[model samples]
Target: MRQHLWMICASLALVTASSAMADNFGMAGCGLGSMVLQSNGKEQIFVGTTNGTSASQTFGITSGTSNCKDDAATVAAMYISVNQEALKRDIARGNGESISGLASILNCSDSDALGTSLQRNFGGIFQNTISDSKEVAVQIRQSVYSDTTLASSCKAI
Candidate 1:
């Protein structure tokens, strides 16, 4: 009886481990990171980090509308653009602003802001950092409560 019990526990452990591994593999195939965003009972965003020494960031947002996918794409693009701008400013000023400061300037308050600031101010935000090669990725999982996700990307210059 004890042997049977031990076998069952081991089997359960193996199953759990395999399930977790499968999930990770599935995410990798999608070219996305481990973070997934879901809101309004819908999946809305996915983010992935790139491997490199340069500070990089990427994110996607979906709103369940005709422009949902496009809006998400735009957000990702703007994130990169804003990050580059912030990096230039930090380099010129020689100051390291908190992630919050950078986010405030971008009018964002969340992990997305962190990713945006890192991209905009790579030089200062990730200077001499071992993780510079890894991109801080963000993804919009859902946008039901707020259309700001779409507006932010659309208004980005």
Candidate 2:
């Protein structure tokens, strides 16, 4: 029981620490995050362009050294944010890939027919939007731990 609590806490901590950040809709200031970054194996580069309100104040913010746009960062952000939604859909539909992938991440493997059971009972654990994904994750961990079939679905890590 104590071990189960620890694992749930750890999973929540990890998810909270790694939630995606929303994108900047307007001209954004250049920071080190904007200056040096890369994702999806592509080069990352961005510029602090002159906005209508502050063109004179923002002189030569862009280096213009690289031709690549900042799309790599944008796509990276999108992928992370949208992945949670995709996982929810996949779990509801019992997509094997999504289930197995999530199991691997959470270090829970099926010893018996845990996957089948989870598919049958998915609605019990996932019935609403995950406003706090980390909290939801913790709840899921606790649920999985308490349920015999769900616990069997994962390998003890």
Task: Tell me the lDDT of model 2 at 34.
Answer: 30
What's the true lDDT of residue 94 in model 1? 39
- Expressed as tens digits, the lDDT of each residue in 56-96 for candidate 1 is 21222222221123333344445535564454455345344
Deviation in Å, model 1, residue 74 alpha carbon? 15
Score each candidate by Cα lDDT.
0.35, 0.46
Candidate 2 lDDT, tens digit per residue, 1-157?
Answer: 9999998678646533442232222234333323222121222222233232334223323552222234432333333245656656666676656556566544565622435545555665566665445543554455567777666645542
TM-score of each: 0.22, 0.38
Worst window of 10 by summed lDDT in candidate 1 = 51-60
Error of 1 at 102 (Å): 8.9
